[model samples]
Target: MSMFLITCSSSFAQKNELKELEKLVKRNNTTETAALLSTVEKMLPQATDDQKAAYYFFKTKNLINLANSGVDFNENRSKAIESINHLIKFENETKSKKYTTEVTALKNTLLAELVDEAIDSNRNKDYKKSSRLFEQAYNLNATDTVYLYYAASDAVNAKDFDYAESKFKDLIKLKYNGESQTYVATSQTTGKVESFGFDRKARDLAVKSGTHTKAETIFSKSAKPDIYNNLTHILLNKQNYSEAENYALTAYNLDKDNVNSLLNVLFLYYNTNRLDRFEEHAKKGIERFPQNEILLYNLAIINMQNNQNEQAKEYLSKILLLNKNHFDALKSLGNIELQKDADITNKINALPNTTTSNKKRNDLMQEKRLVYTTTLDYYKKAQAINPKDESLNELITQIQDFLKNN
Candidate 1:
């Protein structure tokens, strides 16, 4: 009976000590709370689970205050998360209803700090660190889907492809939905890139109101199209062409006007030797961006591959009109002329020996000479555009020899 009384007395004393700690928490006594946490932790084995939960609860609160005071924030943040999680689990299982309101408020405060830190880190391009903070915040507060999305996006920015892919797939599984995004656009009238007129005022109002009210934004969650495109880019980088093409097509189907998706599909089709599909996209790209020099140049190559010399010449001429010093287009034009000149040489060779001096033979030779001259002229212009190509120098050497003999 004496031993039983002693055990009861010890338990009662421990509860009183926890009550004192609770008073310190209520009074916001950071220094005293911090000093007592270590002593409470040492009693964990002897303490009841309720006492243990209270101990962790105070420890978490104390450390969070310390974090706000500019102490080792990362260390304190990590410990606070660990202790709070345990505290909540114990409180819930025991149905103690202990510190529930304060706990909820405390958790939200931690989450806000974590989100702020994540944004700062991402702004500084420390994507790896940003991803970690956001993922931590997401785990702490499961309801805020935004944190999870930021974690995945920053993972992609960091090039942690495996993690990003997993999170993106999870996003799909969740059927995550998002609102429309306003974006800065070039004014067709002014020909100047700028945000819409109301964006600044709207953004300021949102900031003042602490809400995501209507304002210009990018990378908003309606993410299926972007997610597929990003997956396609990852697969393409890994040379997984089959999967890349599938994902690229999915992205295109999601948003037809997405130029980036179109470009990815075009590249995938061309690389995978789907010439018909490649031709289709190339033509579409030209229709969409008629003034885009690279697209125009690519269309020329498509025509050249199909042996439509006249069409190829027309495309190349359009490029020259846009930028006369387009070296590759000029070189390709020279190549087509050389190919025609080769046919003339073959016709001359097919003639009988006696026909060499005839008017017909002379006329054919004259046309062949003019073709050679044109090839040399175009090639020389291309060489002038970029003087470093040794292949061009070699071609010039051959052209000079042909001109001297002819």
Candidate 2:
């Protein structure tokens, strides 16, 4: 009975292995190749302790071939790491007696490949793509402090400050006591002083500067929209409003529909109280993004201030149509109605017909009161949602006091 049970177990395991291999081969050119590889990996648990090492070797070779055949490096790298880890585990199980040299060689080869790919990608300015590869290489060999430094530099170049700071702090913790080199001091016999300074002073300076000056310079010289956008942000932060406006203008000139630059110019003109420029930019921005609440609000405010009451009403009405809860638009609309009411009252009082005059005046005033009440309610709701909004709270208080008096 024991012999029969052993035979049945071995047959089942062999069938499973054969099924996995068949699946792998059938999935040769599909995205399921990785899934197939995982299925084969599960079969390793049933492998004899000695056969595990050879199995991992075969798996590594197969993955390498797949990678060479144009599978993605990023995906293949993960598979290769899995195979190497399995081989290492099996070698350790055998007390490093079997496949120790092979496992070490494979690890070294994969590490070198990862480092080379990372360096190549970094040099090509593909920072996001290189970051994962560099991390893998660093993990394989933590002794190489240079990899961490390079990774940190790349992160900084990519504008990922948090990642860069983490990597640099890790290097500092490594306590790398600077690189050593032979130096020949100046002497009467020696022609000149020769020293190798590997303090990474240049790299440190580049990182320490932390200014996107180079990016700005490139923007100024090449007129690239992305660089111009970045420069605009930097100049805006520095309060160089004129330069920021110029950069934003350049970006807008390159791409007329660039909402970012358009909005920047709009805010710039608004802050400087350049009403004419604000109106011009606000109109353009509104045309580009008609449904934008900010654009509509800005345009409405400008129109109201300029006494373009009808146009202001149009914009406010559009905003209210889009968002019935738009408190600003509601308030502006109420103000416009109040102004209309005053105008109607004055005209009605001047008319000769006393009966029609009184009727029109009462109707207009009632309409004005209703609008005022609606505006007050909206302002109160907005203030409740954002207690820090003093303007809304003040308006609500003023309207409530006015309603109490009248």
Candidate 3:
């Protein structure tokens, strides 16, 4: 009877249920596939926990198959998530090598699918959804610096800067000395083009190690301009203006034309109230880009602060010639004219008995009228360029009224 039963079981009609499931899944007959998977799940209680966990993994594979078939993917994803969680739980409870390995493989596969989904979401500009998927991928494999870096980038685009910073910190923390060089190379090759990956690593390590003094010594030995720029920014943020200035000067010496370092030096001077140094650097910036409207404007502001009205006017006139709609320069010119009018009014008041000066006052008034008319024309042109500036419109109205009344 035993021999006869073995022979009957060997026939194709009594084949293994799991093998039958494979055939059904291959045929894309989801209904039959689901039914077979459920039957296998039912057989788990009588089998070892490893067998039960293996059945759950098969269920996860079926879920992935459904996900790939373009049929109710959300439901398929949920099913896969549930099965993988159960597999993880069982493997942990039983400490079974077979179950653990299978679960790990399934987790990795799921994570890869999630990463692909994130790429699709990003392509569609669904950044929030993409970030969620990237977070899922990171949770599955925290050691994957590539995934972590991408997640951090997505967070940054979403304006979650704090979270992005934290993610970057996590990646940097993963670097052991032996692996640091490799990590730096991989970060450069695979990370965002604009990101400072290894420098970020070194910075975080320096902070955590509380050996920034040592790190600074080592960094100074190399004297990289980029490193100096980063350190300068940090020092500036900490309100260490002197140290910041030193770093900025060091970087400027390395690359004289570096805009960031130059700006940093100017900022240091401005914050430290070193007006002389500010003026010096402002002159240097102007000399470097003689035609730059911004540099010219900055020079005019410095002159204005020094009570050098004629010099300020000269720079302001140059700016207005280059950019006629320079609102700041126009306003400054108006203020200067008002100051001149105040001084002339004081002189006229002091000479009350000089009736012969009436002719001179009349000529001066005509000159003021011509200047006001020219200013009104400039304001009109500025209004045309920037219609959204209500202040400009108001100034135009005031000038028109003043011209009519005077």
Candidate 4:
């Protein structure tokens, strides 16, 4: 196949050629603008400062216009950024100030456009697309760390765990305290939506104008705690317990009251058999969240693990007081009472051979019967909560049989 190249036939020595490029750029004709810019770049070494400035600026302008027009998606975004850099370089080299305001505003406008699109994509539940868009926006402007946070959050929503982990790690490395402005369109408001960068005067004017109201700055809370907790969750899901625990500890240190992080710490310690650590935080969690049923249940479990049945029973009892239908607590209390039956049976077995002490054996058997009866009552409560549970039903039947035989 033969290829045809369309170059600006008019020489750069002619002003007509520059005007033609400008016309093509304004018309959003990327194909022809790029073709002419390619030819102009070859002449840059000998071109006048003004000619060179015009060339680079219009190149950026053309690409940006194409991006705005949606003629090309990813390609134009990168190309526009690249060309804008070249234009900025030319301005600095020539000590010229032309197009400075336009370049700065357009660059910001491009990033804002990307952010808006990402929000739209996320609103529509296209999390994967939202992640990619926010990622592109962040890459285009790394200073906007909140966009990176949004990208990571979207990746999590998409279940792209590894990618989300990497993005979150980057935020951690930056010590990014995620901050962003939350604009609420109140019933009473003022100012143009695009009018950002509010100072005292601007804010006052905005309020007076009655179309814009700046919501409170979201600076009090750092994004790092959330970031660390998110990392912990991802690590836990991947079964990387050590790393998960480390991240959870970091989050806990950052904010001791972070429930997810604190709970993760408890879970990591408990599941890894670090009962001491589990009990320590579990108690602290209970101190903070007195009415938290899950923490109470877990505390009871930790006590049970250490054979502190009385303490375990106390914790479970509190849960029952708060929520009578707490099935887990009911089941756990039933199981603990069953353990009492086992203890009494052990006592009866250890009694000297019945021939040597029939009376002691009889007393032990009487005590065992009483314990079994209590076990039946506890299990019956559990049965009321879940009658179909096979284990509970079987235990109840065994207790009934023992009572009958005794």
Put the candidates in TM-score order, highest first.
4, 1, 3, 2
Relative to the true structure, candidate 1 reaches a TM of 0.58
List runs of model 4 lying over 4 Å from the truth.
1-18, 45-53, 65-72, 85-94, 179-199, 206-219, 241-246, 271-273, 294-320, 323-406
Better of 1 and 2 by lDDT: 1
Candidate 4 lDDT tens digits, 85-186:
677777888798777788878778888888999999999999989998898887777777788999999999999999999999999888898654543333
Give each model a TM-score. Answer: 0.58, 0.37, 0.46, 0.65
Q: Can you write out model 1's per-residue Cα lDDT over 1-406, one digit (the tens) per residue? A: 9999987887787787788888887787888887777767776777877687788888887777777777897787777887777777778987876667778888888888899989999999999899889988977876666677788889999999888777766766776654445444444456555553336665555445644433445544467788788778878888899878777998888887777788788878877889888878878887887777776777688678778889999999999999999999999999989888777778878888884457778988899888889999999999999889999889989989978997
The local distance difference test score of each candidate is 0.80, 0.65, 0.68, 0.80
Instruction: Compare the candidates by TM-score and give the number of the best one.
Output: 4
Stretches off by above 4 angstroms in model 3 are 1-256, 291-364
Instruction: Note the clash tally of each candidate.
Output: 0, 0, 0, 8
Higher-scoring candidate on lDDT, 2 or 4: 4
Tens-place lDDT per residue, model 2, 306-355, is 79989998988898889887767776676665555466557656766677
Locate the minimum summed-lDDT window of 10 residues in model 1. Answer: 210-219
Per-residue C-alpha lDDT of model 3 across residues 213-304, encoded as one tens digit per residue: 22222221222455466557667877878757776897788777666677778778877889889879877886776667766776677667
Q: CA lDDT of 313 in candidate 4? A: 95
lDDT, model 2: 0.65
Q: Distance from true position, residue 266, model 4, in Å?
A: 2.5
Q: What TM-score should be assigned to candidate 2? A: 0.37
Q: Model 1: C-alpha RMSD to truth?
A: 8.3
